[model samples]
Target: MMKTRVCACQTKDVYLPERARVVASEPMTATERFLAFELESGRPLGHQPGQFVEVSVPGVGEAPISISSSPTRGAAFEMVVRKVGNVSRAMHELKPGDPVGIRGPFGTSFPVGGAMKGQDVLFVCGGIGLVPVRSAIQYVLDHRKDYGHATILFGTRTPAERLFVAEAAEWARAPRATYMETVDRGDGQWTGSVGVITTLLPKVTIQPAKTVAVICGPPIMYKFVILELRRMGLSDDRMYVSLERHMKCGVGKCGHCQINGLYVCQDGPVFRFADVAQIREAI
Candidate 1:
């Protein structure tokens, strides 16, 4: 079993109550993007795939980003971030030695152990959505003998926006894993399929009753992907998705991150399709 530790912090500390160190940082893209940080004191973030962490830069505030590394790896945890907003812009400027506050491995994660044990898994991702789904894919790949076949169908706005090119190429070559990709529009050198993420769904074989579908993508991508998954015969309960929202506190006490009654910060950034379907603005 994993050990869970609880710590108390004073009121003046604006950090996430857990401080992680910057172990390694590298840019996966040319847009000033990089991933840097490691847990300092706590046990490894024992979380399922599709969960996120609340990272803070002291006075700079916090942002919730999905944990990109798999727990099964037992290496340093990782988060992939783009330099888009305030906190992310600030985060991009930091070097490898800087300190950042982290609180969580929070929220529900993809159902991987029991539910996915003997089932075929289909991962549909777009743009940065690959970050969260990467964890689960890595987990499944690591324990390939424990699960059924796995297929990954990914689409990005363009080839330049592809998140994990090298890894994606490697997974494509793996035995039990079939990797396929598409871009909305491609330059001349691109040879992969070109279309929305939904377009790739029909290319794969999905055994609905024996498969689970996990999707992560932009707001506009989720509904369409879910619709496609349903058309493929995957039930709502068998479909899972991770959501992104502005979050202030990692815990549920703060009202800043509430999506209706659900706290996106604590309750989930990941939810079953059935659980979030009734909640307006959840997509």
Candidate 2:
């Protein structure tokens, strides 16, 4: 695998954005929209998985959205936006061929190499948490022969709420991949496991010492899931998590995304469990 380059130092203003045209937009769920774009500059968005970009709408303002597609996928980048506020609501109104301002592919990313090299990988995602986690998952899949066993455990509130249904189906069928899914509750048509994601852990075979796990979800879910991971004999250093917080600025200048001494926008959206454990209030 080629080494992913860190972005070049910007001599010009970083706040200024380049023009980008929306190439596709579709509904992923009632609240979420999947959007793809390509820069007018014709440059590849060389972003690593777990990083995010600050998307702007001129008048509607900008918000940091995680890049959902792997950099290895294509020249176009993707984002999954949930309509919860003005900026995201405006984003929901966007369509193919529309133009928008693009700021950055900022922040830290998952350690797909070095520390994680040659280890069994277990991806644990909850709800929309899969959005960012999907990037890293795809990177692993793209270079399938480079890694060991890969197991994915995804959970949602209900069956209909599942995201990337088609892609997940394909991953389930991929060679050397173990995919399992669960829901907190099931509708009449549901036939899969019906329970919280933690319940699925006991059903999978994992080597706690040789495995590296990445988890992303709501704060409440993180607490319980991490507890279960601990119970499974996984050490804190071997586990990683992606965190979410209010991030007014994509860089560390703004304090909104601060978690104790770390900035989620700069230091991490992804962090090792050993470091986060030092902050009592962090999940």
Candidate 3:
């Protein structure tokens, strides 16, 4: 039997937040805000797609936000923050030119490098899961020549609740890309497919043996999606899932993000299903 090897993470005072300036802020939904920020000195956040950064609102506190924009895009990074609590509420109140604190570009990232070149890629994002998957999708789109066929599946509760409304349309029409979107429930104005995100899987044309599936969403969504992927003959090693938690500290010190013995904040916010499947706490 082959042993599973976990990546080593170097620890430091990863809690120290860097000063950043909000260059743009737009409301994506009633509870979510789209924010673009750059470091004080204009240094790139240097984060890979699927990694997360801690954004602080002065005394209000800090919260982990997935880097939504791909580094291949530009110097600045973006985050789609949902206003679920006090810290997020403060983040939503931020405007262009406002100052904020940022710590880390932490956690494991989706492998879009050499290993993924020329391979079919399928991204399954549910609701807010699209926030992080957007980065990976953009990276592939920008370097389209380096990969094989690429597909993106997005599911939300309604048309009004969708994120990246404009980009989603563009991707749907882009060459070599397959973009499908569905809503669990539709409104009078909604005309697209209506069903759970997993249902969209049947519409995708993928070579299971050559595809790498990246799945993220509410925990419950993972099970159904994985079941479908398995039915398609994809192995656990070929599938990756992002598991976000209350990582109180970006460094592994705070046990808040631990599942059994592994720290989700350090070992992953992104993990290959094969490694996570054995852990009882992991979905």
Q: Better model by TM-score, 1 or 3?
A: 3
TM-score ranking, high to low? 2, 3, 1
Q: Candidate 3 at 173: error in angstroms?
A: 2.0
- Cα lDDT tens digits for candidate 3, 132-231: 9999999999998988888999999888889999999889887799889999999998889999998999888778789999999988999999999999
Compared to the true structure, candidate 2 yields what TM-score? 0.95
Cα lDDT, all candidates: 0.82, 0.90, 0.90
Which sections of candidate 1 miss by over 4 Å? 1-16
Mind sharing the TM-score for model 1? 0.90
User: Which 10-residue span in candidate 3 carries the lowest summed lDDT?
Assistant: 5-14
Please give, for residues 144-251, the per-residue lDDT of candidate 1 as tens digits.
Answer: 888788999899888888887899888888778899899999988999899999899989988899998888898899999988888888999888888887766767
The C-alpha local distance difference test score for the whole of candidate 3 amounts to 0.90
Model 1 score (lDDT) = 0.82
Say which candidate scores most in lDDT: 3
lDDT of 2 by residue, 181-241 (tens): 9999999999999999999999988898889999998788898888899999999999999
Model 2 lDDT vs. the true structure?
0.90
